[model samples]
Target chain A: MDFELSEEQRLLKDSVDRLIAKEYRFERRLDFLRRSEGWSRQTWQGFAEMGLLALPFAEEHGGFGSGGVETMLVMEAFGRGLVVEPYLSTVILAGGTIRHSGASGRMAETVERIIAGEHLMALAHNEKGGPRHSLEPQTRAKRSGACWTLTGSKIAVLHGATADELVVSATTDTGSALFLVPAEAEGISVSPQKGYDGVPLAEVTLEGVSVQTEFVLCEPGMGEKVLAHVIAEANAALCAEAVGIMGDVFDTTCEYLLTRTQFGVPIGSFQALQHQAADMLIELELSRSMAILAALSIDSEPPVRERNVSAAKAQIGRSGRLIGQRAIQLHGAIGITEEYKVGHSFKRLTAIDAMFGNADWHIDAIVEAGGLYTA
Target chain B: MDLNFSVEDVAFREEVRTFLASSLPDYLCAKMIKRLHLTKDETVHWQRILNARGWATPSWPVDCGGQSWSPSQRYIFQEEMALAHAPETQPFNVNMIGPILAKFGTDEQKAKFLRSTANLDIWWCQGFSEPGAGSDLASLKTSAVRDGNHYLINGQKIWTTQAQNADWMFALVRTDSSGRKQEGISFLLIDMTTHGITVRPIETIDGGHDANEVFFDDVRVPTANLIGEEGKGWTYAKHLLGNERSGIARIGLSKERLKQLRSLEHELSASGQLDERETVGLKRKLAEVEVQLRALELTQLRVVSADAHGANAGAAASILKIKGTELQQRMTELVLELAGPEGLALAVDDHTDGSGGWQNPAAQFYFTMRKVSIFGGSNEIQKNIIAKTMLGL
Candidate 1:
């Protein structure tokens, strides 16, 4: 039907675009990343004030009740800015899980804190060697008296170091369950490190981390379903983000080709390089379409949502690689330098590809789901 | 943005599907489904069938006897036709010169050609590329000097597809030799039966005679045959080439070929002819191509949607061409791969056996598909267009 954004959606896009332009400059982002907190708390508060932090939550939860398209707009803008904040981890991953799992009472209070930028949350679902789509956690959760103790490690907990609470997935006697463990819990330790794209990541060790019964976000056996819901949303967000990064990277590469002269003319005038640039654009456009498809289908039935999310992730992963590599190749030596925005965008795109299942993983998932031939 | 078709669009698709199901000839559908080459008469017969239903030229304007469907409607019609194995309407008349004539032809010219073109009463072929002007078509040396009342044509054109079957040829001739190479050209419509006009068949690698080398030696064309102004052929040719490139993506055809490949794979697996490793590899390759095809389909929808909103989709068309052709070639290759030894059979007439070991024309189809990337301006030229016009490179 219609591909045009509504007037309200256009305004949201313009506001986000303006915000990124004003505050999330490439150099400013680097400065924010270098701080002790690894990101600008002021910018986090800015997102809250701008209503982006509350965009995806229910209006009853003191939020905007915005849909996937709205979240995609903000995520894409964040991607263009290469914003070094934990929005994916804090909001879509952890906050989304809580919302989907029917978090109430204390958990709902935590969601409010997250929306207000007063607290940060990271979903610690990935274990050391679990399958990419598997949410059956290896971490153990045992209830004794009035408390449940978690005892295992979650590797690559996005923004775990800075998060105020960790939405930890653990296997219980009945099945898997989600527990909100405080970052400052007595038996928890976080080894934080800068990821490939200079974003804060941590390997969290939850050694006998005790949590009250109220901290469990959902009933037993609901963890996998909740995690699946959260992952789908995160996948959609990452796909949109990759589209943004690839788009910018493509623009930067095209600009470089037009301006950077070699021999007697702009290097872009050369047919060989021009063809490569065209391939990059093709990849970017395809990725964009896929991202839109994923975003639009994020809230569908589980099977349909998973299929679309996997399709988007697979396409984005494949196209992102081509666009990123071709972009660097077109930019020549300058593309690989840290000083250039193109390279930084390439780095972020690469990270997004590896996150939430890469192309090969998603393609395999699709093949396993009746092999794409039937569809 | 919503990707689902509207209820009306869905109803239109159903209407088309029902029409195709009941109307398409079984013999023609059999040829199409098997990728067998259809004869010129067969193609014209199918066109007549569509003409009888008043759906022959979906893309043309209503005033010119076209259905004047929306872009989405046209796309759905095309997709449904391909899926139903309906023969393609010859592009020369329907897609190429017809649109140019509709836009620029004089009232007299339109009166003479528009109805006949839509009814397939006249078969047309393009005469733009010369021996030395394939991608660089502006440098063509096909000259048509002015005589008393007609242009004295004396030049040659190469890779003129379907010329053997054409009753007329819409050509580009060098009307001026002093100005820029692109400025001196003139668009002329030449009768194929004109004296001194030679249509020599050029056998392609696929062992087919679909193209030719058309030589013009003192061929006379009435002044009335010229579509537009002299020395403006390059402009008209560019417009025609844009139309040419737009449909050359062949998304519907690729979807059909992909579906055929899957069926072949299933057939091979059911008979235990494909090993487990080969089956897995085939599935993986099919999955990859399927994903790319789906993306291309969505990209096409975006372009169509953008066009409906009055936005320029020039570069998006180029993108579709590049990906569409590549996917086409890839699917054909997979078809051949699925065919195994049967694909290697050369000079095989039909893909049928009494024992149900259907012999696919995959090898010939694959060989023919190579031209998809090369013709209608090579994929390389499409990239050049994208770089220059879209990226400003």
Candidate 2:
């Protein structure tokens, strides 16, 4: 089996890499992050123009029709550049879920807008006390003829503070279902929350928030499939992002060690310090492989998808924490300072880790599906 | 871009599996599967068998008794061997010195050493490391004073793995003390049976005697034994190190360990009432490690595959060593954890006969892997290499 990217894939990666080098400079992102929003709208539009925001959805939905591996490559580049767009929340999780659930017409129109960078959607799914991807929803949806009123709050609505609309999960009389509710709907309130990576998130309160029957994003009883797809894609993207962040983490740590000196020589010259950096490199590389595998498994049928995603999340979660913690530890006291980019990168890695499921969470998921041997 | 193996490679893998099953002695395989150190005779016995079949040096050039397999085929063979618990051919001979002589040794050196080296007639130990010169190997103080037609060697070498059983050692000695540390050094091949030579086994923390401290008190060696030109030894030694780093990741062995960890977790987590959730959680973590191990193996395949096709100096090997060792330590820790109170067993001797079951070897194995990240050029060095070489750090 070959592991090298195809020539076309390599060219695409090069193009993306060159584009990020020109446009998404770290200084620009740092400036944007320190602002109230913690993200740049222009950069978001640029990504849309690049066709990145549409890479995962179907062609019919105005996307590039690229699968998970391509998505992984782009997200990894995004992670390495520390791109602070709502690609994960708006494009991947929420928009991907709607596309996967076969939502069309106006919903399809919104998806197309997202593809064109005109509008964005955030997924408001997780509630307090609920583990990631948990199907048992605490929020309720009451059916009133052609209208449905959503009650209860959704915490951790990724990019919720910025999205024009939200695809939320709630329990109905039948089962769990996905609803497209307007972000500015009456009785709906959103308070911006700070993600560890300085990205904007929100704790959304849907007090009797209402949606029309046509706004349902998933087949009434098939929310399970939509939720599964969203969680899988979300975790896969997070894994790719961690792989990217660790790439940055390894570079930052290596540069520090090379320049930082102790006992009259660069610390990089010391075997003790050098060996630690090498260990980080190992984790980063292996994590990249797992991330690719998870991204590849995104469209696979159950069992394989569960196993691959679980494995990727678990491995990336473990390595992400190690790389993040060691990146700081090796960088010494300066690493923890807000002034250092390594610290910020470490925070982002930690957040990606705790997002979908921690190492332990995914590990359990793998076993619950079947042993790796069986899978 | 295809991820599926060619039919020939697949068939080659099956051939390796069959050969390992029928050819390797059951006892030797058992030792490997359990990560037990092979007895001297057991190692030699297996190597001879492999030599006879011309599979002893799977990656060596065919004219020198190497297998005629492609790069992917050789990788598959190595992976299958490791997974089947077949004893790894002694690295000092196959991986380190043999390749050095083949690539850089003089024609005379090749005629004298190649065949016996491949056939296991001469057991070799590396002498690059010294007490004060582990990572900064160029700083070594071991000197070889030139005389008429011979050189008198002086000073000591430490951490020489398997020197006690070695017939010869390919050593790095100071030949020109006036020049730069790296430039002044030379590679010397010394017979371990020479006069004024002393070999003392240094027991590592894992209770293995494979490592040693070797001393030379004016040991005399013919100039003919020097590899390449004087002071060019540094260049040859670097070549040797480059070869060493090529396979230091050890993916095949880690894959076997992961499988063992999974089975152990299942056996432990299923019995009686523990916090079922935590038990399940721990098992899941073990599975995750296995998954990562598989990914690492795939990366290894890519690296070794490219290496076969002449893509050397890639940063992927650095990545492999880092993640492979970490995962190894994690697997050991998980096994020990599952062993619970049984993990604290100080009875290292219990596994000597392979009766430790799963519990006995778990502790000692965990302790042994603590050195993995430190030895064979520590993981930290690998990262710096990747940074400079691959990422342009």
Candidate 3:
């Protein structure tokens, strides 16, 4: 019935907006991207100081308990700023798995370290040639007397080189399980690279890396459930981020149309471009609604939650492509340039569409999940 | 933010469902469900049923014999009615002119038209679009010059739906040839039986005489029929258009069509007539459209919730109009595609009652739905409004 944000949610949004507006300028982002780590340590600390790293963790685990809507607000602000930090990789993906599967002792301690900004984590669930968003990993975990050995490679390990530890999903005889392996663990290798959007990524290879049995993040056969949960949350965050990017790109294009003129009057006065801009607005608004729906249902039962997340992801992919492509088309030559913010937003949106699952992938998943036939 | 209805709203929905189940005659529901055109008598009977229950004018102010329901209540009523296959209460009277009169009419005008409108005693038709003024309504050349206690109206109105059955017509005519095109217009109510008035049928692509071209040659209309001040017809028309766009989404009607589509798909599969590849393609198309419709429905809820809280919903309403009408058109196309070879039979006589299984009427329905996107302010005009009001272009 009510769609208004709570007062606290509004305050969280304003604070993030203020921080991004102050520090995350386009030129500043470029400088940070060129650095050795490809992001700002100072900004990461600022996020930790702002309690964003702790927002989604339970209070019993040294954090302030928040939900998907809060994460949506922060990610939306991130989208507006085009922030290149590892919040999605380290916080939501890795940290969320730890919290969901890590019931006590050392795993909980690692979460506290994450909250305190003393440790960063990355998730290595995606393997080479694996199906999109498949939880049954090809990576194998072999058990010994008091330790486990992992042998496999993970592709597109987001923030893999920068993280202190990685939560890797590996299959065993019974089912799949998650293990917390140190980034520099013996027999582990990290090959860092830049993604299409210029954020840091790496391909992580495990050559018989050994880990203590206590490093098992969750019980056997629970990896898929935990991974699905975290991925749904990630999808919700990405949906919000896409909305933010589309909003900015749309606004920038509209402004360009008004000020950049060719034939006597502003080009925006042309009916063709005006209608295109209106279409962008429609896509953006619909994406916004879907994002809200996804965020609100993130904590529901598995069927409901997965259905909503897939729906949101599918919509975001389609709308993101539409808005991004139209934005570049409307901006003419400047839209494809590296110097312009609109092009960068387009790149990020494109990357987000490919991430988790693209539109076609989610659509198939939705149909298989019975989302279509459900009333 | 919560999206669930309040307890009272939920109960109201149940009440509406119950009322519709018991009161809406099965024959009328059958006609609507089959996409068959309802005769004027059928439409009036349904309207009177709603009127007798005091649920006819849900959007008007309470003092004007309206139910004074909240936006959510109105939305629920609409959704329930559409799902129940109940006939739409003929928006020309209940939704269009009734609100205009309630908002801007003199006390005398209100007393004369409001009750009759709610009771379906008078069937109203709109006369805004002319030959050259479809999307650009301001360019309409229809003029009404002043005579002794009357206006000598002389012009033509095209695409006036149901004019053949109309008892009265609310029209916009140029009262002065001065200043801006929008500044000289006046809104006038005319009796269909007036002298010099002609309602000639315009056969549509759907093979129905549902709309007409109304010609006025020195049609003497009393000046008392004017709703508001002279030269202010555009403003009043804008108000009515806004109301028109709000309900243009037609989510409920689309839902019913979707239900029928599912049944047809089932029938095809059952009879071994379904092509697997084509069926798969149709399923994907149906799923995509359904997903978009669901999003549109939520977007509508957002607008309704905003309206309930007294937020400006003009831009939101335009978004609904664009998406709603597009989905409606898409649904019709899907239904036609599902009919396969049978959809080519468009003649009314070719259709046997309850025997053709949607194919006989599917093509006709598809042709009729093309008008939805064109009317109620063309989707292109809606985009222009959104650009100006929402995008600040």
The candidate that achieves the highest DockQ relative to the unseen native structure? 1
What TM-score do all the candidates reach, one by one? 0.97, 0.86, 0.98
DockQ of 1: 0.74
Highest-scoring model, lDDT: 3
Q: What DockQ does every candidate get? A: 0.74, 0.38, 0.63
Tell me candidate 3's TM-score on chain B: 0.96
Docking class of 2: acceptable
lDDT of 3 by residue, A1-375 (tens): 778889999999999989998989889999998999999989999999999999998898888889988999999999999999999998899988977885686666777888888898999998878665779899999999999999999988999999999999999887989998999899999999899797799999999999898888876799999999999999999999888889888888889988998888888988899999999989988899999989998999988888788888888899999999999999999898898999889999999999988888877777677545466
- What is the C-alpha local distance difference test score of each model? 0.86, 0.81, 0.87
Q: For model 1, state the Cα shift of residue A166 in Å.
A: 0.8
Pairs with backbone N, CA or C atoms under 3 Å apart (clashes), candidate 1: none
> If ranked by DockQ, best first, what sequence of candidates would result?
1, 3, 2
Cα deviation of A202, candidate 1, in Å: 0.9
* Superposition-based RMSD of candidate 3 using all C-alpha atoms, in angstroms: 1.6
Q: How would you encode candidate 2's per-residue C-alpha lDDT over B184-222 as one tens digit per residue? A: 999899999999999998987776677899999989999
lDDT of the structure predicted as candidate 1: 0.86
Q: How many angstroms is residue B130 displaced in model 3 relative to the true structure, after the best TM-score fit?
A: 1.1
